[model samples]
Target: MNIIELFEELKIDKNNILLASPEDIIRIEKQINVEKRINPDIDVNVANNLILALKDYRQELYFIASNRILYTLFSKKNYSRHHFPPLQREYDAEKIQSFINQFLNDDLVLYFDQNLSQNKFDMINDIFDFKNCFPEDALFQLNKKLNIKLDSVLVNLSQNNSENNSAISYVEYRSFYVLLSYFSSIEMDDKIRSLVNIVSERYNANKLSDFYTTCISSMQGYVAFDPGLTSILVRNREAAVSNSIERSSSGSSSGMSGKSIFFIVIAVLKVLFLFAKCSSH
Candidate 1:
């Protein structure tokens, strides 16, 4: 059954459907025909089935649209890129609150409120907080906003188990790489190093080797470098060596020579450089 027929049978006004914009409605109409191709029998209860399917599709679209709106607002408030256009003047807090009241159900609002607390807007968790209304939807929106490809890895990582639920997921790793690329492009390697430090401490996963290997293997052909990522990596390694030296001095003397530390840092930096270069290629 077509979407129009299903809507008519369900007594739903196509224009007044909750949480759907005009473009979404048009896409829904097109998608219904596509869905019908999978079950073209058109049985006696076909309209009911179609209505159910369309409702599910509409809900999915609603989550996607809502995620995009929220992320856009968050980016505007936090990142505030000078090159990007300003958000619509109509999207102030009062206007957004009114829209939220009119459009979203209470359950969704509460979910968003709970998740918003977890978003520091400085790390991957800000984009993929599972406590959110729909974390998968939010991840998709973040990828769209950043123009990156990370959905497959994100899905896999979401299904895996981690200690303290704080293990670094593929989404987190890829986002860290992307952030490095972005900051490097803008000559902001310090920001990249700071963010990496924050994520490393927050997640506390002792799997840097695994993370590096997996990131390189998965993103080799799909990733691109910003020429600043190399600089970020070098600086990060230097900072790591400096911190190691400080800790060693403060604690027990392990007799680790300066030359040994220099070589170790170089080796680590070279590996990171290779990873970044391979991903970009």
Candidate 2:
């Protein structure tokens, strides 16, 4: 398997690794080192970068994932309607907002590291600098109340798919499809793999295009989101809250609880922190 494929395989178990025990972390490291030793040609740098893009920066990754998923779902719809998918369906922007809020909360450990003032407007703006997949003039009402500017580079759901369509494919963004599939998960929505393929076929970047096409071909085969993801995240959040409350009520050692939650949070957030450690001018 190529680097992208191998990283894809590793990405599948991100959340599992995120919540692993201390000994499990050690075992995982050993297994990974063993695999690298067995495969001399494996691009360890790319594999490590893929992990940074997919698993690290929990808040940032989810923010990007939600935007990209929303762009995919709502871009083609009538921006004036604001009904999300089907007009007759019950979905709407309010539900979307709720999902973002619930899913983006800290893993119940940020409060310890620092204060949680929760004003992410600046961070949101910075992320959009790298990518904003929303359609032009999309979510007009939603964007008006929210202080955010969104101009789409690619993936314009506003336009129908065709030769003239500039939506969803670009050389600079070629790497994103590979990362998105892993972030959303293959089992969640199989459409991701197809979307990755579509982007792969758009060889508009000249010489750079050939390099990316090869990368995409090597990375083929993967997948999702919908109301299903929203529901799943909501349930997970509720359960986490209930568990936290129970532990607190049980009079468990605060030291143990803090250590456990802190460990998971650091494990998940570490790579992204290192990835962006070198600030760009």
Q: What is the lDDT of residue 48 in candidate 2?
A: 60
Q: In angstroms, how far off is 279's CA in candidate 2?
A: 40
**Candidate 2 local lDDT, residue 103:** 35
Cα lDDT listed for each candidate:
0.39, 0.34
- Runs in model 1 deviating more than 4 A are 1-11, 16-97, 101-166, 170-191, 195-208, 215-281
Q: Mark the 10 consecutive residues where model 1 has the least summed lDDT.
A: 215-224
Cα RMSD of predicted structure 2: 27.9
Q: Which whole-number lDDT from 0 to 100 does residue 131 have in model 2? A: 26
**RMSD of each predicted structure:** 16.4, 27.9
lDDT by residue for model 1 over 1-281, one digit each (tens)? Answer: 33333443333433244555667656755654665566564333544444443454554322322343343433222323452334333323433343333333343334334443343224444443322333344334443433322233333344544442343353334444543232233223332333333333322233233453334332222222443445444443444445456556767444345664464455445545554655575
Q: Pairs clashing in candidate 1?
A: none
lDDT string, candidate 2, 65-92, tens digits: 2333332221222223232223222334
Shift in Å, residue 137, candidate 2: 22
**TM-score for each model:** 0.24, 0.21
